[model samples]
Target: MDIRPTDRPDRRTFAIISHPDAGKTTLTEKLLLFGGAIRAAGEVKARGAARRARSDWMKIEQQRGISVTSSVMTFERDGLTFNLLDTPGHEDFSEDTYRTLTAVDSAVMVIDAARGIEAQTRKLFEVCRMRSVPIITFVNKVDREGREPFALLDEIADQLALDVSPMNWPIGMGGQFEGLYDLEHDRLMRPAADNARGFEGDVEQLGGMDDAKLATLISSQGLALLREEAELAQAGYAPFDDTAYRHGDLTPVYFGSALKDFGVAELIDALARFAPSPRPQPADPAPISPDDANVTGFIFKVQANMNPMHRDRVAFMRLCSGKFRRGMKLNQMGTGKAIAVHSPILFFAREREVADEAFPGDIIGIPNHGTLRVGDTLTDGPPVTITGLPNFAPEILRRVALKDPTKTKQLRKALDDLAEEGIIQVFYPSIGGQWIVGVVGQLQLEVLISRLEVEYKVDAVLEPSPWDTARWISAATPEELKAFTDLHRGALAEDRDGAPVFMARDTWELGYVSDRNRAIRFSATKERN
Candidate 1:
């Protein structure tokens, strides 16, 4: 398989998403092993439970045993490169899952046969639908007792609202689980009993029970079945394409036990035949202008590492387009100030670094590029702004006050860095000079508090941020109304308590461009004739 950065490389990009403990990580490890991405699969050993999907990057994720961030990996299978993204299943990190769906072209919605379609599964499925990313269903954990494959599929179809069909069916579930009947092939293969891979069942009796499905499988025949599954596998899932299903261009459903490695070969065959490579769509002309001489990319994430030489701030960037190399002069998207690009780009393998020249769709890390913020597009072309990235509005709000006066400076710096990292937003209200912040949930607040005391030596007390309203004053004269409108050019007016309320630039939008050196200043001064 060619893993080169070509316009139409034979690559399949898909994300594996499911509710926590639905065996998503387990299934992911099996898939990766089958695809030859990893030599041996490792399990995420939590307090007592062993979670498999949590890939390398053992920070807070190990203790929690739930993926807090999305991890990217690529594997080769039968002349195709599968670029798989494993996303967090917990609701606390739903925003991370939402953004990841935007980056992938397809997804595998892993459903626990025992649990069926769950709250997180439904929520993630909705995000994929909203992004028009097609999904393939993998009903996992059939080896476990009470895991009903058929019932779970029906539940998923009902809850997720999809026209569901089965590509393969489990022959026997639990201890009786030998393997699976490949409905398309009309044949069965016994899983290596000792090895125990996922979705594998001993194809004890192929033409056994379900006569109708058996007849259909027989009619399709060996060669025809291969061709049909091959065609569907090649198409991958296109969330927006209705014709995909009509023509069997998307993988319908595949069943297996991720733990036992049941039906791994069959699963491999399906991925090789169906998973898309460089899936195409309506093309928009390249945004990079011809005359633009500088390399342009956008920062997606940041990591603050404490190394011996220099406690570096590593930035994760996506080179959307254009050629960027070391020592290139470029401007940050929002600020429009010239900044120098330095160092060879690095890729994250667990926590280790591998240097490479990045292309579009490649995620790389940069060092020593100060004041660069998330969503800041760097370009040598005409100054441009790229906004509307998936940012969850702060649903849970809280505040932390400094305990020691001496650590105020350190606490303030930590808060500023957290805001820049897209983890939290700092707010200062008029009532009390107390520091307030907002984040997705309480765990994030806990992490912030710990980091302040342990990492920065800044002890603080956290409290829920209080909501306060400010009084608005307006003059009765026409001149005053005109003056107010001019002062707030981009102001929005809405009814509040039976009176018109006007709001200016929101603090939420400000976080997107937190790296700006100085705020953009504009004036509306007119000379009196």
Candidate 2:
């Protein structure tokens, strides 16, 4: 098949990542505002009758003012379709964020100017680096008192091990905040004081280094400081190199206050001009190219009951190549069965519209009916699996049961659907087949219970399990697997996907099992083939 350059230049897919309360959601809203996706940008925390952030549509998220699940939003700007994957900032939901990252081509790292690099930010950055995904840094909350611009850049370079290229320089920080200097265009952007959350600003063309108007706007002292820093940044910092960025070696940094809507347009403009389009995705047997004739994609997320009015499930699929029509037939890689996609929906937060056709880098929602699961690949060609979706070992274990015995079927279906979404890992003991759930944290358990009661109308109770750790077992041969299972018959259980798992009561028990069974390998994570 012949593939040509510029075949998918109009597409751009990226994710927004940050630590909790670092203004990640705010930044997302402002970007949507610039793209004309929303008429008025809403605050993350709004009072009575005020609209909340469109990206945060879930009831829990709206009430808590925090994102617990990743949201996919798409917008069109300058003839380019941009898919923005807004990830959860809470550390408790990092697993979901990690999965979301796997589906994006690039990432936008939002940093708090005052706090600098944070724990969650570092973890997310490491994942990005591992994938070699290009990153764009936005030093947020410059409108408030925060770190010095140079110091923030230094921190990013020293901590993240990324070469920093300052695309624009901040005029003044905190209360004295004036605006920004456009380095490439040699222009001064003076944001209107009353333009908070609106897309209106003033620009002044800087003729030379010694402009009198610059001194007047920022005061003489501030101008001197700006000039000194600007000269130093130009001479010392690395220039923005597209090659380095594509390889994840360098990052272009922009300073802005997302809350006030200042300096947002500049960042969006840069993404439109330089960010990469949909690229080839790695799949089993062979990599899938964007210009491939057959339709191909993967389900990275499965959300159940997005709308309370209708108990519906939507599988979020990222189109890696080819065009996806509303009623196209494709092979489910997991099941090896051809299925027709009848409802391919596009999303603007929770609001969705049926999409007639979609291209590479677009995320379309497929109405699911117990057939889809996270990490399942779909294609019109031969069955090809995209690996690297991880099933992390759960830390918290609970033996859960339905409050009403008559609703057994309802409880089973609810648990299965939630487990399929990766919200929690459900396990069945070998002896009685009792349901035991394994989760990364207690918050996940809470969310699962809340969802069951609210969405599924099933009441459940969780009792503490004695196990502290769980591991998946792998053997070289059938005999070895049988022998291992026979020896530890009582400890064996099956995960939600029916994979064998061994639960240990404590570290000592785990060590004893390892010493006793020398042939079996215990793994903390499971990789799909």
Candidate 3:
């Protein structure tokens, strides 16, 4: 065995998060364009790209024009490697987004310059705060009509309770829009009137905010506004404190239009320069560091049938420490089975190539079948489990109403496969003949239907189930759990893991059952060990 040192190349493993229609996917593609990962920006559909080259590859995603599943892409800039995990911005796929957050060391929170902060953005932000994930804020669509930059910064500071440092200030907004005055770098970018490609612009060097060239770029009225705004922003907000930002206390904000490609380059530069590299990942026994000499990683997501031709399942693993070489057998902690990984995948959204070796902070996909699952830890050295990902209780529960009853086998396989992918949760009642599907949000129901029709070719309809919510029930002892299960056998069910689940019509019924069965634990969330 060859000894390897703990020091490795600097890498940034981060996820992009925002509310739906906030140009998250667009920003993702634009970042890819800047990274030299893709050639063109693709067609605009709603706020995202609709071309086959776009990141939203799922058929339903293309049809709905929303990113329903998280996409991982690896790109390099300068000498640093960046693992970009573009997460679903919709609130329905919050579970998948939350799970994806577990794998990223940092996050880029996108806010529509017009809408500012939104509900889903807040939800994802809270999750990041809970995990202490450092965030870089990108105020998108600055070229369009939007709110006042100062007001947006105030809202972010007041609502998110984080110190926000504006790295750049918009010269003017809407019709009078000029360009962005890069406060940090002392540069100015203006929309090129002639000889320009898609979202390309011209840049001018400056001598800080007081540069005389500011007058040439902006009109008299806009120039006054820019000076005032830039002065107030610098004096009012704390400067980009590297320590505070890395500690998840301060966020450096950049103004850019992802569509117009205004501040996208600067945003990428900010990530490479400021975003923390792979940090200590929270685990069960201990947090894992990037400098650990052992190869350690955990499967944060499992996607089935990414390529229709192969019908292969890809388990997305965030390498926490050490270098991972091809054809290395790592011990699967969940099953205690040593599995050999042959074709390790490096993703460019939908386009992928086999990775020969990967380092810490890189996301690699392991092609497998019914072997790896989300939350399962794998290591080449000692036994340790990476924690922090847990399944949320579903708000909506439905029973599979198969149109073709003869395709029962196909329906079973489809549901099982999707469940393994963390797309939906499948619960089987102990006494009922129907299989119940549980999802965190309503859009997931639509996603479930579309995936079944397109991916699995299983024609099925999801009808409202009798139960409104479910709770995974457990007891101190097996005998006690069995007794509780026997008493409520009609209301009891089992998840895909065969863990007992208690179903109820409403919150009142759940409370009633919980009040009676004091000895039994009705858990709203389940953590996979």
Q: Relative to the unseen true structure, what is the C-alpha lDDT of residue 376 in candidate 1, on a scale of 0 to 100? A: 65
- How many Å off is the CA of 369 in candidate 3? 0.9
- Model 2: residues >4 Å from true position, as ranges? 1-6, 43-53, 193-199
Task: Give the higher-lDDT candidate: 2 or 3.
Answer: 3
Candidate 3 error regions (>4 Å) = 1-4, 43-52, 194-199
Collision count for each candidate, in order: 24, 0, 0
* Model 2 pairs whose backbones collide: none
lDDT of 1 by residue, 338-430 (tens): 776566454323433344344444455667535676656666776665433544445565667777877778877788766665666565543
Clashes of 2: 0
Model 1, stretches more than 4 Å misplaced? 1-6, 43-58, 76-80, 185-187, 194-251, 263-297, 306-310, 321-331, 337-349, 368-370, 380-387, 453-457, 468-529
Candidates in order have lDDT scores of: 0.57, 0.85, 0.88
lDDT of 2 by residue, 1-529 (tens): 4445425778889999999999998899989888877666863222344344478887677778888889988888989899999998887787888889888889999999999999999999998998888999999998889999889999999999999999888877887777778787878876675745222577788775578777766677768878998899988889999999999999999988888877799889988877888878878889888888778999999998888888799999989888788899989987888889998999877777799999888899999787888899999987788777888888889988878888888988999988888888888888764688888877788788888888888999988786888999989998999998987878889987778899999879998998888899999998753
lDDT of 2 at 324: 83
Cand. 3 TM to true fold: 0.96
Candidate ordering by lDDT (highest first): 3, 2, 1
Q: Which candidate has the highest TM-score of all?
A: 3
lDDT of 3 by residue, 1-529 (tens): 4434654547888999999999998899888888776667753222244434577999998898999999998878899898999999989899999999999989999999999999999999999999999999999988889999999999999999999999999878876688888898788888767543224557889886677887887688878988898998889999999999988999999998888898899988889889887888888789898889899999999999999997889999999988899999999997899999999999877777889998888899999997999999999988999988898889999999889999899999888889888999999999979999999889999999888898888889878789999999988889988888888889988899988899999999999989998889999999976
